[model samples]
Target: MTDSTHTIHPVWLRATHWLNALAVVTMTMSGWRIYNASPLFDFKFTKAITLGGWLGGAIQWHFAAMWLLAANGLVYLLCNVGTGRIVRKFFPLSPRAIVADLRAAFRGRLSHADLRQYNAVQRATYLFVIADAVLLVLSGLVLWKSVQFPLLRELLGGYEAARLVHFFAMATMVAFVAVHLAMAALVPRTLLAMIRGR
Candidate 1:
């Protein structure tokens, strides 16, 4: 967690992270197309196709991407269990270091130890993104079949509630990706590390 060093992200971590990114992007787009269908708004869940030729087809794509995301996410989580990367390098809760990082950022500089690594802000963003993805999966399930999963539906305050939460969370993630990309562009070397194993 200092400067003057570079520890490459393991290949498995890089692979799962990028694959998951693609899956999330595809799923969000296709899922939005599906939502344009019935929309479940106006106090109704009537069958309707809002953005595509068929709601069913959109559902298929959405489910496919969802599964892909799940697989990548699973691998990422499993790798974390034994890798110690989560605790040692990625958890993002080191208060003192975080404070220092903030100070450096305000001064338009990277903390000495974070020059070649994800800074505290980056670590915090990554953690939030991870948590948001988990929420997306859970909320999707809650909205998938409210009748079949009564307990989950109830926990999410019913299908409508779940749907709303899921949509908002998905939108939030989309926004995060937009911001993430801008940051990547600003710090090209950091992006290079992910793509070219720098």
Candidate 2:
């Protein structure tokens, strides 16, 4: 297809992408502060890096970000489905293709020549992160309202188990974000494409 016939990142996608990014960052920082209030482990995130000055404030920030994430995520998912971008971009995944892509990536031979199409690794990773975000939201609901969501709480193996699941999900998301940013840095055009929709 000619350049005039396609856009790398559509406007709705770019909007949702930036909004989701903002929500995730806010939730993560506030979450660190909330986690510090009731230590799940001995370690604590530094006050400097965490959001909100106190536990109550942090909880407020976390809740606000939660709503933003939920609403924006819904829009993103619906748009992807409605537009059929989800299937076209992330479907037909295979273990063999992913393994080959991984090997090529490690060897610095994976191609990013096509700005519009995802390789097997990108498809897998994006799909994984989407599921991870859903898990985070479900587990977070249990923690946020255990009394109201007792069934969900029990399904996740009680309150404490939900917390653990949420923590791990957050960690996984953070790692994904880190690698995503690294890849963007390595291929700056990808970042620009998201912004410019070229």
Candidate 3:
């Protein structure tokens, strides 16, 4: 396809992407603050960088951002699926191709010329993150409403297990965000494309 034929990210995708980013960041920060209250791990986040003021405030922020994240994610999923962009741009990933791409990436030979097409690693990462997001939402629900969602809570192995799963999912998403930001730093145009849809 010619340069003019290349399609940028649709407005819906771009808008939802940024909105989800904001929601996730807010939720993650506030989540850390809340986790500190319960002493889940040895390390704790300082209040300076965290969203919300205290445990109660953090819970409020987390709940508010949860709604935004869920709604934005649903819209993103629907748009991508309805437009066939999910399959067209990210499907048919092969293990062999992913291995080859990893090899190329490690050797500093991976190409990024086709902004419209996701490379094997990109496709795999995106898929993994989507699954991770779904897991986060389910686990979050179980943690939030363990008694109300008995089946979901039990499926996740009860309240304690659900909290663990939720923490792990949040960590995975944080790692993904780090790598995503690094990739964007290396290829600034990708970030710009998401912002300006060029």
Q: Which is the leading candidate under lDDT?
A: 2
Model 1: clashing residue pairs?
2-113, 3-112, 3-113, 36-50, 37-50
In model 3, what is the error at residue 128, expressed in angstroms? Answer: 0.4
Per-residue lDDT tens digits for candidate 1, residues 1-198, read: 323145466678779979988898778767777776656555422334222346777788888888899888988988987777787767647778778877887787864334345677777877888888998898898877767888888888887888888987887898999998887787777677787555
Question: Which one wins by lDDT: 1 or 3?
Answer: 3
User: Which 10 consecutive positions of candidate 2 have the poorest summed lDDT?
Assistant: 1-10
Assess every candidate by TM-score: 0.81, 0.97, 0.96
Per-residue lDDT, model 1, residue 177, is 93
Residue ranges of candidate 1 with Cα displaced over 4 Å: 1-7, 39-53, 92-103, 111-116
How many clashes would you count in candidate 2? 0
lDDT (10s digit) by residue, model 3, range 1-32: 32546547878988999999999999999999
* CA error at residue 5 for candidate 2, angstroms: 2.4
In model 3, the runs with Cα more than 4 Å from the true position are 1-4
TM-score: the better of candidates 1 and 3:
3
The TM-score between candidate 2 and the true structure equals: 0.97
The CA lDDT at 122 in model 3 is: 97
Point out where model 2 deviates above 4 Å: 1-4
